[model samples]
Target: MPVIDITSDPEALTMTVVAEFDAPVERLWSVYTDPRQLERFWGPPGWPATFALFQLSVGGRALYAMNGPRGEVARGAWEFLAIEEPNRFEVLDTFVNEDGSAIDGMPTMRMTFGFEEAGAGSRMRCVSHFTSAEALEQVIAMGSIEGTRLAMGQLDRVLHDLREYSQGQGTQTEVLSDTQVRITRLVDGPRDLVWRAHTEPELMKKWLLGPDGWTMTECEMPDAAPGPYRYAWAPVDGGEGEPFGFDGEVTLMDAPRRMVSTEHMTGTEYPPTLNDLQLYEEDGATLITMIIMYPDAATRDMVLATGMTDGMEASYARLERELLAV
Candidate 1:
């Protein structure tokens, strides 16, 4: 978690957030300035940002949209107010419509971002100035604080080299919240191939099997969004475990980059989980990030206790060995 503290002051009509990073001031500033890097962490997990226009100069405007897992979008714009190289910048942030026009009755705030060198790294202090206490309260009630914190928590992956940060990590799982779990794996393959391995039935059957002695018996891949997809596996040679499968609908798909789906166990009435999968390729390899939102904490715990992470690791290792290496 990069965010150190967040404070709100009604009298001052401002909300401030302070965060520390293990990178220098210049490095930290570059991530904010570069649209590609900014997109990686501009939004919280499961809601990624896409920048349509980024003009980094005083009086210029940047337009972007945060895309939700369920195909929802929230558009926003930033009008640059000040820029001081690697030290600070200011912008007027506003909620906007699809056409880039300000949304009616939505409050806009002036934000100042300051970067300074800390002991071995850097620190960022951001202050959002509101027109009135009511406006500040409104934003807080809308989850701005927690959203900002979660967004900043993703910065470490952006600041560090992908391979250095994730290679050999296998399939790692992090409990993001009571109902949310994030899983990541670095595969030694290109993004397109990895994406194909997930979406194509032929390719998926080659590596998606959790462990040896199991075979993918059924693989029904959906061709488009809102379509049904299912996968089933069975033990080979009369092995001990019973056959099992999962069925889901692909809710959103951005070819080779992102896909969102709702997953549920076949033949069961368990509540479905939302799965947001994203792929990022760097240095000839791809990083797979999947965030799963469970129905409740109990369900989350139940799923984790089933050795899901270990199964995923085995599958990913097989992906590299059987599919990618070949």
Candidate 2:
């Protein structure tokens, strides 16, 4: 019953979200593909949910029931029509009679889940096809829109805080010539996951650097905006660490694709770091390329001398491990 943003018209339903989580696609995919795991996080903010019937193959059914705060319950089911493992899933899901029968005069619908890599995390989009605009209206009215948002939000939180060891943190940026460092190693995991390691704070803290006492003090992504946006990672006062910190002002926020920013949106205390991150689908996985354009030869050379390629390889190693398990 919270504010539900209208994403599509009521008839031909379509909802698009490009959120970057702190985990790789494999981990994200497992949470949706594995029913036993999926049920654990299907409810909205305060509801506890459980899966009732599940058959995870093509043509199977994935059904779930949710218990509200007052103990009232609602049930839903998606008839799986296509299952492409971690890549795509199509299902005809909808509400039914309290007795579990298809409602006689209600909206019938089909929602498809598509997966692709976006910068530093997996981007999952739900394309819901309705029989009519009226049907689309009916489904969103039943909370499908907000429910999906909440469900995926939980996935992001889980991945960022996963028990996996924090691997690498803080790297000096630079421009690279394929040969100088002999350091370019093609990471086997998806590039999108690597993007998360760089930007998403919860994961970034584990692998990227900031002031010794740095913690993300503020972060925001406007639904639509230009020019200044903010990302603040600064040393925690009273914490035992150096007073290193950097603030970023938005150059771009394409979401799950790429983001460009200059240093310090709030003030100019810290030097600017020109950062560019890209994510794309490639042979069997995602390929991520990051370019840091510096002002002169000195800073670029200083960053290169830090041996970032090896640092990148080490952090990517953690990503590979998590994906294979999921």
Candidate 3:
């Protein structure tokens, strides 16, 4: 984690967060100023931000919305107060409505961010000033501290070259919390092809098989949200483990970009997991980010213990080789 410390002062009516990064101040500043890069980690794990408007100059404003996993949205805006280039800046941040109007009772804050060189790396100090101690406490009670930590934790990946950061790494999994797990893999294919591989039954059957000597026995894809989809697999020789499958309904879909669905074992009563998958394409390759929300810590651990990451890597490798290589 990059966050070093977070402190709140009731007397000063403020909250301060300090974080250190392995990148330089200039590099850190670029990500914050660029809307595309900022959106990558502006919100927490499951709730990703999308910047609708960004004006990066003093007296300018920015509008963004954080989209939740269950089709919820929270809108916010920032008015730039000061700009000091690669070093510091200040903004007035406030909660807003879909129409860009300020929320009547929501608290607003003034925030300052300072960046400085720390040896070969850099350090960032952020201080947010509130109108009253109650305002600071309100935000704290809303999981702002943990949310900030998790959001900034995603910066390391944004700072590195996408290929250098994920290529040859196979499928990597990170436990965001007890019930939330993030899995990422870089596929050597365009985002459209990767999306097709996941949605088109013919393309999926070619690489969706988890391991060697297995074949997809069934694949029923949904046409859109609220539509049910199912997949089943079996041993090639019918001599190994018994056939198993998963069924779910596609709750949300943003073709070639994002999809959210509920997943459960075909014939089991276990609680379904929420699967949020997002794809980003750069340099002719796609980075797949999947965040799975489990029912509980025990279920998360049990699923991970089943060599899920290894199986995913096997499938992705096959995707690159069989489907995308041509």
Top-lDDT candidate index: 1
Give a tens-digit lDDT track for model 1, residues 1-326: 99999999999999999999999999999999999999999999988999999999999999999999987898999999999999999999999999999999899999999999999999999999999988999999988898998899999999999999989989999999899899999999999999999999999999999978899999998888879999999999899899999998998878999989999999999999999999999999999999999999999999999999999999999999989997
Model 3 TM: 0.98
- Please give, for residues 1-326, the per-residue lDDT of candidate 2 as tens digits: 11223267543455544455555677778878766567546775334467877888777876777755333577778788998878788888777756667766676567777777767766666666777767766766777766666555445433443222122332223233321111222344555665565555566545343323346665543333245445555566667743433455555555565555555324443345565554434443543435555556665576567665655655555445544224
Off by over 4 Å in 2: 1-6, 160-326
Better of 1 and 2 by TM-score: 1
Q: Is candidate 2 or candidate 3 better by lDDT?
A: 3
Of the candidates numbered 1 and 3, which has the greater TM-score value? 1
Instruction: State residue 111's C-alpha deviation in candidate 2, in Å.
Output: 0.9
The lDDT of each candidate is 0.95, 0.55, 0.94
Instruction: Give the local distance difference test score of model 1.
Output: 0.95
Q: Which candidate leads the pack in TM-score?
A: 1
Worst 10 residues of 2 by lDDT: 177-186
Candidate 2 accuracy as lDDT: 0.55
Ranked candidates (TM-score, high to low): 1, 3, 2
Full-model lDDT, candidate 3: 0.94
